[model samples]
Structures are given as C-alpha cells and as structure tokens.
Target: MLLKFSRNGRTTKALSCLLSEGFKRNARPQQAANLLRPSYLLFSPDISFLRRPSLLVKRVVCWLSVNYQISSNSWSDPMDTNEASSCLVEQLAVDPERQSSSPACPNDGDEKESVFKGLGILDRFLAVWIFLAMAIGIILANFVPNAGPALQEGTFVRVSVPIAVGLLLMMYPVLCKVQYETLHRLLRTRRLWIQIAFSILLNWIISPFFMLALAWAFLPDEPELRQGLILVGIARCIAMVLIWTGLADGDGDYCAILVAVNSLLQMVLFAPLGVFFIQVISGDSVSFEYAMAAKSVAVFLGIPLGAAILTRFTVRGLASERWYDQVFLKWIGPWSLIGLLFTILVLFASQGRQVVHQIVSVVRVAAPLIVYFIIIFFATLFICYRLGFGYKLATTQSFTAASNNFELAIAAAIATFGANSDQALAATVGPLIEVPALLGLVYAVKLVAKRLGWKD
Candidate 1:
C-alpha cells in the first residue's frame, strides 16, 4: 500500500497513532522497511526531497540507520519475525520523535534560504550597477569626447575591439557553467525539440512581422527609424541573452543551445531577411553585408564558446570535478559581471552623444521597442508556462524571444546606411532600451514565478 504524507499536523498525529497500534500488534521490521522504501514514501509536495530524489533515498537510509541502530552493512539482513517484533515495536513507538529530531532531510524553508542567499551582493543588486554604468558612460562620453572615439577606434570584424573583448569576457564564464556533456541527453528529448521549434517560430516568423507592424504603426513618418526597427527584428540575439537567462535563474544549458542555433541561423538568414523586410516591404533600398554578419557571429559567439569548452575539459582533466565546480567556477564567475558592466559602460559611452542630442528621437524609438520587449517577453513566458515547460526553460524561452542581436543590427545599419544616419542612431538605441528593459524583466519573472508557484 502506498502511504502518502500530507503537511498537516492532525494527519501526522493520526499516522503516528496508527503506527503505534500496528507495532503493538507486533508488526515486523520488514514491513517497516517496506514502508520506508524510496518509491513508497510519498512526502508532502513542498519538501526538498521532491526536488532531489537521490537526497530522499539518502535521508531515508540515514534516518533508518540512526534511529533503528542498524548498521549499513546489515541493512539487508533478514531478522526472525518473532524475535525482532518487540525491538521493532520499541523503535516504531519513537519513530515520530526520531523523525522530528533527525537532521537528515532539509525542509522547504531551508532549501529556499540556501538557493536565495547564495547570490553575493553584486548579483543581488545587478540592476543598480547597470544603471550606474549607463549614467557613467554617458557622462564620460559627453565630458571626454576622446573616450568615445578611442573606444570605437579599432574594429575586429565590424565590432569595436573593446566591445569584442567585453563580449568574450561576458559570455565565457556563463558558457563554462553549462553542462555541455549533458547537452546530448537534452538533444535526444522531445521537449527540447519542441522548444527549438517554438523558438524558431517565435523568433524568425512571429517576432519580425510583429516588430514590422509596430514600426509602421508607431513611426509612420520616420522611414530610417522604421527600417532600423525591422533590421533589429531580423537579427535574433546570440549574446547577452545568456547573461539575462543566468540572472533570471533560467536553464543555462538550454539557453546556450538556443543561442548557438540562433547564431548559426543569423549568419544564413539575416541578410536575406533584411532585404525582404527593408527593401521589399518598406520600399527602402538597403544593402546588407552578409560577410559582416558572419564575422560578428564568429567573433562574439565562436571564440568564447570554444574557449569555454577548452577550459572546462582541461580543468576537469587536471583536477577533480568537485574542485572545478566549487573552486574554479567561483573564481571565474564574477568576471562575467565585470565584463557586463564594462560592456555597458563602453556601449553607452559610444552612443552617448547621439542619445543626448537626439533625446526626443530616442524616446520615440524607445516607446515601441519597450512595448515590443515587454509584450514578447511576457507573452512567450505565459505560453511556455501554460504549455508546461516549467520556470527555468520557460524563462529561457521568453528572454531568447524578447532579446535582439543589437550588435548585428548596429553593424548592418552602419554598413548599409551612414554612421550619422537615423537608421544607425535607432540601431544604437537598441542596447539602451534592451539593457534595462530585460533587466527589469528578470526581476519580473522571479515575482511571477513566486506568485504562480512555478517550479524548476
């Protein structure tokens, strides 16, 4: 018989009373052992054991060994039913007291406390740092004009050199945290395939068209801004989505896989999609350099991913897995945030002049972008939630859908239109809007998850 444990004081007391009566009638330890079987012990839903099944088994074994004075080696020893009944009854009489005193299992509160308090001060206040970085970047850009030019001076594959470095630093640690060895298992699952199909549908088909409609509706008179918005729509995110996913406590492995797929697709689809959306649909002739887009993908994603893989394998080879996970990961983890802040500073500084001079235009452009982000993010989040994709994967799907590859967008705009053109300015505005918007969504996702009881 499967006996379930509910989180109710009366039910627990009744169960204890029933167990006492059964023990008085000389119930065997074998029956007690069967009751404690990992498969049979149906705990309250809120317990930590529900999240970690192995932990459940370990705790059960530990409880039996400690409370019943059973040796681990003799756990399988068969006792004569008649001889062991009195001892079993005595042990069973105090079973409730033993369980209440046992420290073998963690409760829901302990689990939540550990998970929530694990983050350091930097992680806890990430939004404040990002906002401060933006303000500092703009101040530096306006006060020190040379800073912008110097930061933008050298370009590696159409990305500014400093930005390239920042992207690598930002992505490397996050990618390293992904369990790449487990990716094959995820790839074999139907759920992952479903997620990929949904991502492709939302990102390529639905999102681009939605942004086009919004662009037209909002900026009817501004052709350059409209074209820029369309370009932003076509270039799906490959970078920084990982950071947002990590911040939101989403599935990093799955997010990395989606980012990889998007990068590959961006190289193939971006140029043609740009032509179709901008030239054909909007009647604006814009030349998209396919090579530039390809180069940007290679620089932004390829380098960091390759480095992360190498680092992961090499460290695992030299040291133990525990050392790599506990020591090495902690060492390198903070750099991702450092890289993020530096990237934000440089990004806003580079575009600060345009942001200041064209404050009114930035606001107008920002309105639709903000709407697009919030709409796409929450819509995808709810759809994934209702589809039963749980919180982690659902958050991954939402952020991936909402984020735009602004690097690709900016490079494409500049190569197609002049650097000083409205299209370039609009493209530059993508990060300005996306940074805070998505950061806010990270917090919003947590709140929604809590209120709805969404589990990992």
Candidate 2:
C-alpha cells in the first residue's frame, strides 16, 4: 500500500491526497498537520539516494506506511481498509523529518545534578561527619586497644598506612580538578601574581611568625607541644585548602597556582622554617632534617599531584575533555571526602587514649591554632579586598593562606620526635579544630559575598 511517486511527476499529487486524508481523520486538521511541518524538516540528500531514486523513495514509503499504521492503531474511529491504505500511501509522499527527537548535546545541569546527588547527606554535613569520626576513633582506641597497634603496624615515619592512603585519596581528586591550561593562562594575568604575592607574604612571612607567637603564648611550659604547633604553622597547606577554597566558591585556577607554588616552596623552606620557628618558640635548638622535609613533600604532595596530572592527561587524550570533566571527575570528587573521613578516624583511633589523657594540653595547643585560622582568614580577606580582588579570588587567597598542611606536619613530627611524643599529639589536634573552624569561615565568606553583591 506504500506509495512510490516518480521524481518526474505525481509527488505533489500524492502529498495532497495525504493531507486530505489527515484532514478527514483529525478533529483539527491544522493541529494534526503541525506534526509533519515541512519547514522544520532537516534533510541531507545523498548522491547514492539520488542515483537509486526509486529504491530510496520506495523504502521511505514503506517505513512511513508502517509508522502511520502503528501511530493510528489505538484510535477508536473506524475507517475502510482500502481508504486507510490509500491514506498511508499518500502520507508516504510527504518529506521525512530527518532530525532526531532527542537532544544532540548533554547539559551541564545534568552533570552537576548527578555529582551532587551522588554525594548524599554525608557530604552536605561534612563537619558533623568528621566530629562523629573522631568519637568513633576514640571509642575504638579505648576499648579495642589491639586494633590501633595493628592498624598502625604498616607505619612509615610514624604515618600509618591507612592515614597515608587516605591523604593521597583526599588530595588526588582536588588536584585532578585543577586545569593546567588555566594555570598557564593565569601566569600571564596580573591577579595571579597579586594572589601569589599575597599567599607568600602570609604563608612564609606573616603566618609563620604569628603561629610561633601563638604557640609561645598558649603552650609556653609545654616545649614539645609548642615545637609541634610551630611545625604545623611552617608547613603551609597545598592540598586540603583546595577543598575549603571550593566550599567558599573561590577561584580554583588561582588556588591551584598558589598550591603548586607552596608545594615547591615547602621543599626548599620547610626545614629552615621549622628549625627557625621551633628554636624561637621553644628556646631550644630543634633538629629538622632537609631530607625529612623533602620526603614529606614528595610523598604528600608530589605523588598525588603526579598521579592527578597523569590521570587527567590520559583521560582527556582518550576521551573528550567534556566527558572527563563532567563525568569522570564528577565521580572521582567524592574520594576526597572519603579519604578525609578515614584519615580522621585512624588519627583519633591511634591517638584516642593519649588524646583523652592529655585532653587539657590538646585544648591549650588548639586554642592558638583556632585563633590562627580565624586571624589569618580575616587578615587575608581584608588584604584581598584592599587589593580590589573580587570575592572569588579573595576567598581563594583566604583559604590558601589560612589552612595548614597538617599531613606534612604530622609526618614531620612523627619522624623527628617519637610517635608517642607530645609533638605528634599536638599535630593530631590540628584538624580537629581546623576542620570545623574552616567550615564556619566558608559560610562566612558566602554571606559576606552576598552582602557585598560580589560575583562568585
């Protein structure tokens, strides 16, 4: 019953008969005809189809006839079989709609929604989750004493196997999010240099001096605790700040530059900074080895960073860049939170008994660290505002400046001092105070940005 009109003539005759049949079946002829709007049709005529015109026409006619019968099958109105056949034959003469009904491209909304949905409730209340992790770790340490030692068995330089793995996992996803191309472009931008200078001034000069002073003020009698706090201050953050920066809707590209710069600077300056600060704060000649500092940088920052770069390059080369960012990285993003939670649990579990016994000393040590985070966050924000940077860059600078790389500090403390040393204990208390405080700062930044009408 399919119509195969010749290219020579009868094409218009056949189409008119199809429209007449449609007008008879549909209650509103205009509305039914809208489905076959010829103006909206997208077609590309192939040379082969042109050469085999009868074959092409006949095939299209058959396809249209089948589709028409399927579409009209549920209708209650009855028509003669011959009349229905004539209508379908006529309808086949109309041009086919070549475009797909489905969307041609994926949307950003879908990607973001998928990622956020994947996170679930734990991600939304991350600070509460960390607090719960601390409690669980403490409980494990107190009751299941053997578990802590067993978990700590694969320890290297006082850093437990689980903690090391967690640190790497926590860092990799954030590092992978950094676009090297954006970093390269940022190098040429004046704002990048401004943020760099700002970070260096605070991280190397101002913050170290401030932390040394705080340790002296809070733990004047506890020389070991003072030394550890100072070490924590000297080891500027390169990894965890990315999480805080993202939370504050900060400029990620600029943050990545600062992170990279800080990582390299830590290798050269960390030992000197630790030695100098501990000497000044504790009034004792503190031993700090350059090899230890370099090893920390290599393990904590270098390994994860190298892996991130390799993964990014391989994924981008193998697939589309859009797929890598929107799909692959989106899934990888949650590993950061998982690593953080696991690391916290292990830290508290190992140190839980010790933390309970020396809770007073931990609190005293934490006082200065908490104050340092607050003062440094505001100080950096004020500086950025004075520099006329937007909220995005300002928050990025604040987070980079305020956060410390506690992983490096913990590793250094355990390597130089014993695992059971007060120095290690003080380093362990850092994230307990730091995580909650930074989450508050993130909220504050958002509020301030909205009040000032700053663009994210």
Candidate 3:
C-alpha cells in the first residue's frame, strides 16, 4: 500500500516496516538480509560456501565424513597404532563445529591431513633400503653367485630391472614434485640456466676426468679399479647435490629444473659416456650391445613416476602446497626408503656371497670416489669465490657435481656385466659413503661459510 505519514520520523519507520514485509516474500531480499546479518546472527562463510556450486559436492562429502567420524563407534575400537592411523585416513577433514559461519571456507583440517601424508613420506628411509640392498647384492655376489648364471642369457630384467627401477625412483618422485608452472616461472631467470650449465660441466666434463685422475693416482693399470671409478663418474649426482644446495639456500626452483634436466640428459648420454670412458681409460674393448641392453632394462624408472602423475590427477587438489602438506607427503614419503630396503634385502639374498668375495674390490674403489668428493667440494668453493657465484649457487653446483648417481651405475653394472660383476659391487659402495660424507660436507660448508662472512 502507498501510505503517507504525518511526521518525517514516522514515515521512515513505516517504510522500514513495509520493506521488511516485502523481504519475507522475496529470495533476493532474503539473501541480502542474510549477508547483512551480524556475525552472532548466522554463519557467514557457510552461506558463501553454499553459493559456490562447484564446492557443493565436496563440502557435502566432507560434511558427511566429519559427522560420521565424530559420531562413529569405529574411533573407540582397539587396534594397533598403524591400523588406527590407516583408519584415520578415511575420516575426511570436515569439522562442523570448527567450520566458520563466515563467507570464506576453513580448510584447516584438509591441510592437516595432507601434511600428515607428505611428511610421512619425507621422513622415510628409502635410501637405507637401497643401501641394505647393495650390501645384500654384495653378499649374494659372493655367496649364491650361481644365480648370475641363470640370467647369463641376458634378459631385460637382468639388464633393465635394477636400472629401470632405480631410474624410476630417480625420475618419478622428482617429477611428482615438479610443477610445470613453476618451471615456466623459473625459466624467466637466466641465473638458473647458468647454474645448470655450470652443474652439467662439472658433472660431465670435469668430474669424470678428476675421477680418472684420482683412480690413476690410486690405481694405474688396474682395469677393475679404473673401470669402477669411470662408472661413478658417468653416473653423476642426482640426490645429494640437492640436499647440499638445499642446505646452502640455493634457489629451489633452479635446483629442481637442474635435477630434471640432469636426469634426462644423463639417461641419454650415460651409456655412450660409460662406453667411451671404459675404452679410453682401460684401452680395452667393451660391449656396446650389452650396454644397450642394460639401458633398455633401465626403463623401470617409469613406474613411480607414472604413479605420481596419476596420483596428481586422482587426488586432485592435494598437489597444491597447502593440501600436499595436509594430505599425502608423510605416508608415501617412506615408501622409497622402504622400497630401497626391500630391494637391498633381495639383492643381499641374491648377491651376498659376491660382495663378501670381492670385499677387497669394494675397498679399492673407495679411494677415487672419496678423492673425487674432496676435490670437487674444494674446487667449487674456489670457483665460487673467484667467479662471484655466491656460496649458495656454488655450494649447490659443487655438491651436485660431487655426488654420483650410484643407483644408475650399480644397475648398469649389473645389467651389462651381470649381477656378480666387481664394477657393480663398486657402484653399490657409492651410497655407503655418500649420505654420511655429504652430510659432513653440509656442516663443513656451513662452517666455512661462516668463516668467510657468508651468512648461509
């Protein structure tokens, strides 16, 4: 009704009442009023979330999980802690009471879940498993050396199995962590390419010669010793370099790009370089066919990598840093180490006797690898100071060059010459000294960095 009031104040009061009546009949008015309502009046975020059509389904599902978990009898049941932890995973992170009634959604519980997973994976001992596997391989090589005969006819698993698996481990986890967007963003910096070029030069060009030189000093005219040193050089470092650089605060984006590029390039060139190094250093004929076969088998690297890519899609939003932390990193984190341990157990079962038999060979190979580390580590620092590469980048480049891809070398050794080969045995020793030695360097670099008035 169109109504007029006698007083100005009374007219305003009448219009307010009339508008309130109209709001009760209209959805637009009702929604607007809901927004205008005070915090104490309603849950604001809930309303906003409700308006987001895409999130509606997830919210509903999360809502159900939260309610069910909060009310379920399952939570009270007795079981081993591991079993209980697995069960908790099913409880989607959606706390109703904790949910803000505000327009923005609270994603705390979701984030917590992901962090739980990611950290679990990171905390694992995948390398330990691999290390133990090497020890096992040595034992088998010495003990049940007969098994090597069964695969003597040469099949993919014989050649490619370990290489492929190691490659997969080497490749996949790194790929899983890689964000194409990050790489695209990282490409803007010419410094990253500079670091990469520097890393590659040290890794391929200079590192091999140094290893050869060290081997020459320690073991000239010793084919076994020289060949072993060459393998270490050809493989180069994939893991430990990142660790040292990470400690030194090298740019992670640049480091990541470097790892990806290095891994790919190494795969392509390792065989040829390995062949060349053996020929030049040993002046002996080696098997190109056998090396190719080993490379063929080395394709096992695709597994974890394939799984990682699939997982990104299957578990959708968890790739984001927040969700990754909240959801997946912890549980899968340890699988690599676990896988490595299991692999070691198998290798020990398979190659235990061989390693024991060739204990002397293992000892002999260490001289060069150790010397390689010392030389590169110091040289990198010197170069950094001279070229003004800074401690962070220099330290990173040094460590990457300092470490060798032992897993690849070991697998290639086994694939090419058979599991019981002395060269393969030498390759396995790489990780034995690498992890501990590199850690020591990390501390040492920091100490030296402090002395130099560098704040890393």
Candidate 4:
C-alpha cells in the first residue's frame, strides 16, 4: 500500500503501512496539527539529509553499522540496545526508501548526532599514537645507541624493544575495535580491490619516484637521506589509515578491507620494493629481501596478526557485546596510551645516544614526505570526485592512498638496513608526519565537501 500526496504540483509516495499502523499512526493528529500551523519549521529540510548518500548506499551502510560497528554511545548501551536493534532492523526490513530514487526514508535523521559529525581533528591526530612512538624510536636509536645486537645482526631492542612493546599497547583499543567477521564481509566487497589499486598505485608507482626526485633536489649528495626517502615510501601505515578513513565518514566495510590486504601485501612485496628503491637511489644494492622477510614475520606479517586472529576465536560468543565494550574497549583505549609511553622510554634507553645525530636527517626527510602527501591527497580527492563517488568514498580513497604503511615500512627498513640506516629512518618518519597531516586533510576534505556543495 502507498500514500500519495501532491506538494507544489510534485507528488510523493510513502509506505502505506507506516502511515496506517506504526509510529505515524500514534502521532498522526499531532503531526497534522503541525502541518496546519503553516510555519516553515515543520517543513524545513534536514540539512544533513543533503549530505547523505543515495538510498541504496545508506541501506548497505546501515546494515553494516547495525550488525558490525562497535557501538560507542549511550543509545547503544545495554539498557535499550535490544529495543534499538529491533527498531533499526524493522526499518531496514521495510527499506521504505529505494536507493535509486530520492525518497523520505523512515531511517533518516533518527540519531541525535551522525557519527561522522561527532569526530573532530584532534581525535584523528590521537589515532597516530603509533606514529609518535615511531619518532621516539628513531630518536632513541640514533643518539643513545644500544650495545650491539645480542640475538641477530642490527636488531635494536637495545633501541626498538620498548617501541615494540608500545606498539603492542597501541594495538589494544584497536584490537578491541576490530570485528573479524566485519572484516571478512568487507573483504567480499567488490569495491575493495579497486580501492586497493588506488593505494598501491599511489604508494608504489607514484610516491617512490616523487621521493627519489625530492631526495635528489634537496639532499643530492647524501645517500643516507636519499635511502631514507625510499624506505618510507615503500611501506604503508595500516592502522592509522583506517582511523582517518573512518573519520572521513567513509564506508567502514571498505576500510576494513584496506587494513587486511595492505597487511598481507606488504609482507610479500615490500621487501622487493625496498631493495629496488635502495638500489635505484643509493647505487648500493645489498641482499635486501632475504633479511627483510625475516623481520616481516617477527613484526607484522606473521605474529601480531596471527595473535589477533587467535584472540578473536578464543573470545567468540564468550560474552555479550555490551560486556565487551564496557570491559574491553573501555580498558584498552587508555592502556594503549600507556603502552606507547613505556615503549618510548625503552626505545630511548637503547637509541638515545644517537638521537642527536639524526636530528638534521629527520628535518631533511620531512620535506619530501609532506610534499608527496599533499600532492597525493588532492590528486586522489580530485579523481574520486570526478568519478562521481560520494564524499565518504572519496575521502577514504584519498587518505588510504595518501598515507604510508609505517609498520611494514619500518620493519622492512630495519631488516634491510640497520636502524641507523638513513633508509630505515625515512620509514619511521612517515607516520610522524602522516598522523598530523592526515588530521589536517580530514578537516580539509570535510570543509571542501561543504564548500563544493557535494553530497550523495
């Protein structure tokens, strides 16, 4: 059944069931009274509705958000969660608004604040806690200089041990945030591979040459500085990329795929790229792949991800989501910060003596990283817009492609070249700049969308 009405000679249709039997029936008289008042307030369009995407995208996003997103608010709390879920499910079941056409959907504007509107620049900056940890890692490694490797050649627990611990701490809230099944669904997304292409092209095909040129332009004589740019350019920063994408109101399902694929690809290809880059720029090619492969297993390619998967299985259905949020995420967010601080202290203990020597080098590397980031940022933004993608998708594409995979980069860098290698230093610095830079980019994307009057 349908209720058809005409306004200004244009006709609109609403589901008859909604008008006859649900929330509207209870409030029909009250709603009619407001319509009779003839005041514009009763009829004003929701400005937010302008920014929302086509009905189809919203439906898919709503489904994913309901079933998978980690709830972070009072409305999602235990006291009313079942009822909320039921209501959302009911609205979705009807799908009163078809995606292809503009219609007034019952599901629209129900939340007090859209999640995208809730996040600000500072939160995105905080997402880069790992990047800050990495910077401290470099400072400690360069100046303090630990007693040489006890376990393997060039290993820096003497410097990096604390950084690793801080990284583990940093992973807590993040791990808590992850939903493995949600990630799986995202993997099935057809858009995932396309977005991956954007990132790979940006990081490997485009960014490297830019860095190579920048290194020649500014630090032409220094092979160390040149090597650093190559290392940083090759590896991508996985965790932080998702954080920015989420902040930009991008589809979380797509962002999840970005995380998993980048993690795997970095292990397989990052070493080869690092060697090629170092050989190309520094003209001193060593056996870069064999050693880098080992570090990949120890750091991200193998252990941490495997551990995350195992933890998911062990905890499956052990407790309600409400309990998990209250007990787990609440605890992990703060502890992750502690893990970061402690890791900095340990890294300082190992690498602090050399920190003074690396000061100039960090400054040198920042110039190219910043330029490459800005160029890619707007470039992706332009292409995504031209392709007619929504702000959410465009923003995600821009950031995912713009940022580096620092974890893989740093691991590959150290494995291929000692922590002191200018190349290794470059990878460490990518996150430091990327964290703050992406925050600024997030704000820029939001503001630009607002200015262009782009929506849907």
Q: What is the alpha-carbon lDDT for the whole of candidate 2?
A: 0.74
Candidate 4 per-residue C-alpha lDDT over 356-424 given as tens digits, one digit per residue, 9 for 90 to 100? 467787777888888888998899899889988787778877887787766556666666677677766
Error of 4 at 394 (Å): 2.5
Model 1 over residues 1-456: C-alpha lDDT tens digits? 112223422233322332333332223333334334333233422255566676565545544543353223243453333323332223322355454333322333333332334476788788889999999999998999898889988987776888878888988998899898889999999988988999999999999999999999999999988888888888899988998998888998889999999999998999999999988988987788888888888888899999999999899989977678767887898899999899889988988887899998898889999999999999999899888888999999999999999988987887788667889889988988999899899888987887777897
Q: Write the per-residue lDDT of candidate 3 for residues 1-456, one digit (tens) a residue.
A: 221222223222222232233333221232223322233113333444455554454444533432233234232342233422222222211233433322232232322122112222333333444455566666665566575444334444444344334345544544455454457666778877787788788878898887877777777757765676677777765554554465455555566566667777776788788777788556767654444434433454345545766775566554565455334644344444444444445445444555566767767777667777888888887887788876667776767778777666666676666665666677766665665566567667766765676532
RMSD of each: 10.6, 14.9, 16.3, 11.6
TM-score of 2: 0.73
lDDT minimum window of 10 residues, candidate 4: 35-44
lDDT of 2 by residue, 1-456 (tens): 222233433333333333443443333334344444332111222224456566456545544553464356433443334543444333333333311111211122222222123234756788788889999999999999897888889975457889888889999998899887566677888866876887899889999889988988888788889888988898899888998887666878788888889999999999987776677545688688798778778888888989998999999999978679767887888889889899889988988888899989888988998899999999889877877888888898889889998888888888889789999899888888888899888878776765666664
The Cα RMSD in angstroms, rounded to one decimal, for candidate 1 relative to the true structure is 10.6
Ranking by lDDT: 1, 2, 4, 3
The 10-residue segment with the lowest total lDDT in model 3: 84-93
- TM-score for candidate 4: 0.63
Estimate the TM-score of every prediction.
Answer: 0.77, 0.73, 0.60, 0.63
lDDT of 4 at 181: 67
Candidate 3 wrong stretches, greater than 4 Å: 1-174, 239-251, 290-303, 313-321, 343-349, 390-392, 446-456
Worst 10 residues of 1 by lDDT: 1-10
Each prediction's number of clashing residue pairs: 0, 0, 65, 25
Highest lDDT model number: 1
